[model samples]
Target: MTFPYDRARLDALVADVDARLATVEETARAASRVRMRSPGLGAADLAAISRFANSPDAPRELKDLARRVDAGELSWRDVASGRAADDEGVQRALRTGVPDLRRAYAAIREGEDPEDVVEAGRPRVVGDDEDGPSRFTEDAW
Candidate 1:
């Protein structure tokens, strides 16, 4: 003889599945929050970097670094955390481009204009010397 359908058992199974699904969702959300709390680049950080990368005054090295990040060849978190400094490209960017990038990022975080921050960080062009182009402070380089 065939067994009859058990409505009560089916309802219990459905409720169990629902509970499991809710638990999984909550775990995923908590994990996401934890990740955000960790030291890393956020959405605003990426946006600020992108803007600096696209700016007319941005150096080629910085643009290359930013492009690597956009293409997933480089991790923004690693870059921000200084873990990517071993790379040659990163080394070059760090000399000038990275400092400006940091300034821009900080400015954005502080609710200031990133463009102005980047511009202000740039080495001012002093009077041109007969020897060559204008001189800049050693720190600027």
Candidate 2:
């Protein structure tokens, strides 16, 4: 019995997979760096941002911000802190009635800088108010 597979085709497929894997690894590294710089965001938040950034319908400023984050030139914190507010694409998105874009703009306007709240010794909570009593406080009795 003779095998029907072509060696060249298999080699090309392997090369393509290797390239894709490299791209994925790089993207993960970049995402990790972004998360480190912006502690307020969770994995789900990052995934939503990634999806929006990759969308062709996304504003150009948003895409540029994502690129800058990936390139280590800027962090998601920077963008959240109104870094891209004045960019043309952002302005256009705001003017054209994109609800999500408006929400993003609002976030930029209202977002607090993570670096400002994070202290050397204090632990920062990512979500919810930990200042309130714990849920188990009454149950422990």
Candidate 3:
């Protein structure tokens, strides 16, 4: 059965999915020092996942689960509580999305060169260092 989409409902779903993705991020980072170089990469991946979750193409099961939450049939936190004792619908949603998110996060974090990502305190050259520069070298007469 289909249910009307609500923004708050979708946001809750997105936040739950994002939290699940966070476990993948933290595990990956802790597993390897190299993966930690791009600090904001996890946030970017989570944003992408949120977009995916809200999109029409997101798994129908996820929508149904969200509908249940919105309808007050289930508490949203139960969805990603990470305990086997949680409701089956919540576990199903977690199982459905975690692997895919893990793969996406891996690709996102591994595919980019860390140096290319913007970071604080990194050095940047403002102008040419050659001595023959025309603009700064010439004095106004």
Which sections of candidate 1 miss by over 4 Å?
A: 1-41, 97-141
lDDT tens digits by residue: candidate 1, 1-141: 987989999999999999999999999999886632334456675577677776886788888888888898887678776789799888887787555567666665565654566467667667655554576753654
Q: Count the backbone clashes (under 3 Å) in each candidate.
A: 0, 0, 0
Candidate 3 residue 132 C-alpha distance from true site, Å: 43
Tens-digit per-residue lDDT, 25-112, candidate 2: 9999898866433334555555666676767966676676567667877555554456766766445544554564455444433554
Candidate 3: list runs displaced more than 4 Å: 1-54, 83-85, 102-141
Q: Write the per-residue lDDT of candidate 3 for residues 50-104, one digit (tens) a residue.
A: 4545568768766666677668775444433333336777666666767654554
True-vs-predicted CA distance for residue 111, candidate 2, Å: 14
Superposition-based RMSD of candidate 2 using all C-alpha atoms, in angstroms: 19.2
Model 2, runs deviating above 4 Å = 1-41, 81-99, 103-141
Clashing pairs in 1: none
Clashes of 1: 0
Which candidate model has the greater TM-score, 1 or 2?
1
User: Who wins the TM-score comparison?
Assistant: 1
Query: Global lDDT for candidate 3?
Result: 0.56
